[model samples]
Target: SKLWGACRNPWDTDRTPGGSSGGSGAAVAAGIVPMAGANDGGGSIRIPAAYNGLFGLKPSRGRISSGPSVGEAWTGASIDHVVTRTVRDSAAMLDVLAGPAVGDPFTIAPPAAPYAKLMQRAPRSLKIGVFTSSPYETEVARECVDAVEETARTLENLGHRVEYARPEFDGMALARCYLGLYFGEVSTLMDRAKTEFGARDDDFELDTRLIGMLGRTMPLPDYVRRRQQWNDFARALGAFFEGYDMYLCPTAGQLPAKIGELDTPSHLQMAARLMLLLKAGKLVHRSGQVDQMAMESLARTPFTQLANLTGTPAMSVPLAWTAAGLPVGVQFGAPHGDEGTLLQLAAQLEEANPWFGRYELLEAMI
Candidate 1:
């Protein structure tokens, strides 16, 4: 919070640009700079890209080394990339930053040619699956769903085969597994806070404190089981991709969140709310109300996690706008080593429907 103090959406200052990388999102959207650094451990990159009307891609795991200082992040669930206004910018940056550092644990093969140059022409006809369902069965906003449908039409017009399909998995179980890993990371940060900053419960957000408590008390075997679930989910998606080059979905289940709508409560305030739930016997993790709240919070982002879990390459392309004049993006995910396909498609889409014109309008308004 101290870093930027609630970075707001340029389109509407009363709305958020989206998370962890929201600062980058806001800067790019407002034309403060052409591109900015971003990273995605979950939907950190794509979420912001969707909210701010930019292009953001998460490359295959190990495509960009996270070495010298650290080998992997979030147990390899995270990767570094950038949010960009142009697909070519992202591709050029990838060409610059991608490679294995000495003694790195693993590495992905380098691109056949510089990505910036590769975008010079359209890609060959490919098979694309149009998937719109939220894994959590949460209600996706109409605008978000419409964005996927519109993108599918545009891709088909670009000579790619499009079909309706989705990977099979238990949404609730995957959420549990992901939350377990996330909580473990939070617990680690808590340790750092105590040691370095002398921080305590009062210093954390309500959600962070509660999640940390759960992580501290969680059994070791349970954590292991959650990781195992990650492997299982990855395998399932791998098989599902056998007949398709990529799966297209909404970047978010909803539009950008209004300011203060998704704000984090201070620990003390949250503790009071927790007591009320506890009194009603609804504080347990398995409680229906608790589960509903968790789902709701994640509802806008249920589609982005599968790619992160599988270490696949995925991208958010700014392809549509809502009646309220907000941007909503479509996400395209390819198999673990097929980032080139996503880049090529994004370039083609850029040519078909340029967004710089919209960026110019935003500049005039601001």
Candidate 2:
């Protein structure tokens, strides 16, 4: 926007609303819509929610099918749902969209009760593991850290136990695996675009063309190997969940960046342009620069990818706003097929710390 190229955050015009769903986030946050559809592969939904202060949920794999036209997306890592101002809207929408279509691959166990009904009741007091720092070991903003810390304290006061812990996984390896998916997916999509839509090489953006080149050149074994490592992360997260009812962390490692803060720097852009010109995608991968670039790009959003790779239901709740009047969210993840619990707790949190007032004020100002 500058809320659809309205590129303005209604809360503050200079800051980003966030992306790949930033438009919807901006629209809804500005009260243009009560809710809007969104999806997450590598944190598309939650990232926007964190930056724009909405309630975003990424349901478990197979919770909602990708059916009729396609089976799934991004190796079944992406999930479709809605971002809303209230917990109830999300739960209600899930009720409408939460079943499998005929000829679908598989389905999650249906909620014990309707999620809309299930969420009205408060969850039992339970243990939650909280982590405030970036999983990729990036520098986390103090405000983001404070958001999680305050949430832990609040959870403690609400009769839940909170511990400073996280699922044990090689964060760097996960980043690499995610980037592997990126390369492969982009390559596939670009191929489709070129063949079906009669697109030219220069039709796409430079960064996109470069990534697709890497995907086209990537060896089969390498892609398969990356998918294989996903199970290790899932197992580790499952182990963590066995001891804890849920995991809590920063939805993002940093507060909303001012516009253009995440753009590729001039030096890197120069190098990438040359690589694009030479068509040296594999050379970039072999140089270990992929890891460096992936880490640098992912550092701001290192937290949300774990849940996607692990196929768990996760959410970003609008619980904290910074001193500068910017919103930053805290994330909560639940084990597979356990979105009911997540919704229940979200309902309770909604009551304990009502955020509806903030949105009302925002709507008034807008």
Candidate 3:
């Protein structure tokens, strides 16, 4: 609970800045920096972008290399990039940073030209599928839905085709599959901690330790089964994309949560207690509890995980604000290796409905 004293949203000081790239979001939004580095294994990049009103993109899996330091993270669900105030900044950095480092396991051919130049050119008339409802069985905020609808209208005015549509997929199953890998990683981290410091239960956060405990209970075969399921989802989503240039949806299911609203200390205490239950060989009864808990959290931020599963490029464009004056973003996902499409769209959106002044307002407040 005391990690960073809760990174507060500058837009609405009581709200979260979003994480684990939350520091990047807060710094960029407060005008402390033009941009800041971030990475996403799940919605880490986009969630903060939505919460802080910045442009955040999680590039295709192989587009940027992780090598010489670490071959990959979360089995390639993660990738590194920056969160920026403007489309051009992200584009410029991508041009400078994207490419294979030595001993990289995968490499995608660099863009034909620099991303900054690509941002200048108009994107071709594109067909986009738009959905306000989360594919997951979760409730989406009305403002979030409105933000997406408004962005779709804006795209239509720009001569792009926008139609109400969504791909067919089981959000729950995908979430469960993802959790297996996610939990396993947490468990592995605890192992490292033990090696480095002879860490104990109190060495980690209560919720984190609970997650690690759950991860340990998961068998290696179950983790492998989950990883293999990625291909099944990839094929299904790939087919859905064949009919459209991009998919548009809310970046998050709800507006930003007030600071301390999502504070998990009490919940973590419960989790630590749950660990005791499991150790007493109460496996059958409590195993489902953590999975359900995870699902409840994932339901709120559902849309971004699909791109991570399929290794497609996705970006969150800060498009609108709530009645309470908090920012809300609309997300767009493009085919693998088609980040140009997302950047081109972001530039168009930036030109049509500029967000340059939100930072200035934040600056004034600061």
Candidate 4:
């Protein structure tokens, strides 16, 4: 995507496959492979699955090793697994990747049975809290709302106790913290590029440069404070899980955007260019523009970050599609280290509403 342009969805070229795992989603959806590797920091795996109509799961923190060198990614908000058309493939992949690396910082208990075995059957009588609104209080599209409602109905019919609810937390605050991670990661990586590769300011794209600049201007104490706030969110979600077996919401706040629709608009681009030219990163940060950037960049992606932030297992189950034939997915989040529950539920949904063969039908039409 850096140079080749956006990866278009195989089902409809006008729409994206979602990112940054969108390429893997596209490759799997277009039948290039049965499965491909993916990860989620803030919905990377689930976003692509929602757009491309696949089963994607983000394992709980430390369920899979982050690295042999660095202990974590995105401050433990990210973990790697796979995206697949069938739930079983994801479960099988998890079994393969589930273990402690030699120098891992976090260690999670392994599943009692392998996930492939766990996901083959449904978890009984799940009390799922369902919501369709954005945590950031932004608008969720009508179709996205409808997808969750429909799935809620289907879940109810399947004898699961479905209720309208969400975990208690400051959505905007969480957004700020998430963006803070972005700033720090971008800035640190930019410096690494300069040190490791002799990269210049002009070498990066405008958005990357802007985020990196914000990172450079960010205060270390503020970064530490924001990281600490993640605990509050984790506790809130933990409290919610006391009553709810899992949480259900739209995987994305809206359907996939038309390519380039999310790009910084011309006026903003001009403003950003001016800031970069003048090295006015702190000024922009003080102007409360970061909030605007969060809304612009993350409004559509608010749902999946809770799992990432809380180090819980979550999945996007492809149970709905729009009238235009674009896929929309419903998310299911389980308690920490409870990927087996999410996977089992996903397999149940897959059985009740089969989506695996739709691509073959699309191929026929094409």
Candidate 5:
């Protein structure tokens, strides 16, 4: 079968929509569905949502099922979620999707009532910490900074006390650690493909081939070191949450980039299209730079990834938009088994702002 060239952004026809869940985010933003399914191994859902002006929640790992198909994806880094225009849509989908499959390696217990029900209630006033810096080495866009500041104002209007806060630990080190693990995982997948499916060098894109070659050369100590980094990052986040109910941040560092802005096809033509895709993955995984659509996915998972690693619940709310009219999301997260509080707070914000169910572009698409 012929592969679709690439998914195009609904907002800008010339741009590439995000992936591997780009279609979901685009469909939701276009209003084809109230919300659409998404999964994040490394910012897949949140990136697209950020690009398309929708809310994307990648709940705690194992909080939703990945069963009757495969056990764990990307060595447990991947989690199921949805991209939506409203907070309640995300809450409602969580109600439907958050559960475990029989014989699963890990599963979070279900919430007491459907998340939809909880969204109807108000939450008590809470302290929120805002962090605007990119966890990675790259620079964040000014629009993203402005969006977060606006979110702070919005939260204040909702009666929540807000303050600028930074994580106590080193952001750069955290970025390095995440990259190590991420690359290591990519390496592992490539190795498996070769061994299990007898995949040849030509079967993969250039980047995949490079990753597989690197994986073959990685020492056992490298794996152990990456695991240690995960542990350290998890501990830092746990400590950070002790003083704040939720942490707010940009889903992406910048606005969505135009499709193919990352590279021209001529530059990528040195390698096959498969290689181009692999190169794209490497670019996103290594540099954390993505097109507007790609950034939505790229920037989201780092903050959310810790939640998955630590078994905490987190959500992104479509609370603000850029001056150019692109949607901007504010993320809120809680400790493990704390979806109740998270949803309650989101619901409260929804009531206070009443921004839910307000995607005009999406409605037009239908």
Candidate 6:
């Protein structure tokens, strides 16, 4: 374990920065990079980006290449993207990374123009929908809600029509269905690992081991049923988006947890804690479910998971800061393959708000 030294939290050495992308978030937030690479199966990019005050975009499922390694990550749900400080920077990164590689299962069509170039243009006035609560009935933190409201104001000021609305779908049912698909992938991956390396539970972290165990118990029929649920959820979102160009919400139910709050030697314990936090957030409408002692150890990343499930394009823009001086980001999503509109609007907001980028953080770090 000491081979990599302790994965110290850049914010506070006593804690961890969250994983499996913790290092990327910590490094970016600490001013090591203006943007860093991140992948999200379940909120890896957005969570770290939110924690580090960077912009994170998990584009539509096939938008970016996952090739030169595997055809899909986490059963085609995961994607590669970048976390950055400015919205334009993320858009630019997408231009660089958005495309399927050789042997890809499916490819997302390229944009009409380079996304980076598109940002220099103007975005037309568009309708924006805002929701503060999680689709699964999760309570969002006041800070998160405040950030979304502020973003709404920003959007309105920039000439977009904004309205308060909630999707008609049930978030809890969708979450359960999504979880089944996610766990099924976990099981598949574990089986492959076991076959390849003769590895067992001891080879992975507590959470990974638990995933493996759960994968073993999932029947094929359960997997099929879950896929159907995913389809239903996606169709609901498709209909919801037809009425609006974009949906705005908090990237996470709450702010970043302190580091080291979710660390555990037992994978099952960690997995249980994660599920508990998700369920608690859904039930309570906020993210204080994890013990205060462990909140810093575990990362909270529920709000970003929806985009992953639906294969939609989502971005987290850091536009506000908490009283405690932590950055708060508002997330927005567009329909699959419709990143043009999202980037256009992001560029408009960047021009209006002009969030400090590398220079500001560099000055602070110095």
Off by over 4 Å in 6: 1-19, 198-200, 264-299, 357-366
Q: Report every candidate's CA lDDT.
A: 0.84, 0.88, 0.85, 0.90, 0.68, 0.71
lDDT by residue for model 1 over 1-366, one digit each (tens)?
643477899988989899889999999999998999998988899999999999999988888888888788788789999999999999999888888899778988777778887777679999987878899998889999888998888888989999998888888877777777887889888989999999976777556666676666556887898888898888888888888888999989888888777665577466646753454322344444445555866887898888888889999999898777788989999998777878999999999988878898899999
What is the TM-score of each predicted model, taking all chains together? 0.93, 0.97, 0.96, 0.98, 0.82, 0.84
> How many Å off is the CA of 335 in candidate 3?
0.5
For model 3 the local lDDT of residue 140 reads 91
lDDT of 3 at 310: 80
Clashing pairs in 3: 14-259
Task: Report the lDDT tens digits of candidate 4 across residue range 306-361.
Answer: 89889999999999888878888889999998998888888888999999788886
Pairs that collide, model 2: 1-4, 1-5, 1-6, 1-7, 2-5, 2-6, 2-7, 2-8
Top candidate, metric TM-score: 4
Worst lDDT 10-window in candidate 5: 288-297
Steric clash pairs (candidate 1): none
Per-residue CA lDDT of model 6 for 1-366, tens digit only, reads 323755654544555555467788778777787788888877788776666667777788888878878887776678888777777778878887888788898887788899888878898888988988766554568999998999999889888999997556656555655566665777677788889989775676556554444555556685677666767767878888889888998887776664444445467476566754454323322343222312222224556667777788888777777786667778888899988888788778777777675337534754
Best by lDDT: 4
Ranking by TM-score: 4, 2, 3, 1, 6, 5
For candidate 5, write residues 63-135 as lDDT tens digits.
7778867787655667888888777778887887778889788767677778888767787788989988776
**Cα displacement (Å) at residue 95, model 1:** 0.9
Model 2 misplacement above 4 A? 1-6
Global lDDT of model 3 = 0.85
Better of 2 and 3 by lDDT: 2
Residue range 1-366, candidate 2, lDDT tens digits: 211243667778788887778888998899999999998999988998888889999999999988877787788899899889999999999999998988888888898899999999889998999888777889999988898999888888889999988899998999999999989999999999999999898788767887898898888999999999999999999999889999999999877778777666889779878988887877887889888878877888889999889999999999998777788899999999999989998888889988888988788877
lDDT of 3 by residue, 1-366 (tens): 576477788898888888889999989998899999999888889999999999999999978887768888788888889999999999999998789888888788788888999989999999999988877678999999999999988999999999988878877778877777788889898999899989987777766776777788776787788899999888887887899899999999988888877756676677567665656223722457655775677877888888888888999999999877799988999888999889999999999999998788878878
* Candidate achieving higher TM-score, 4 or 6: 4
Give Cα distance to truth, residue 271, candidate 4, Å. Answer: 1.1
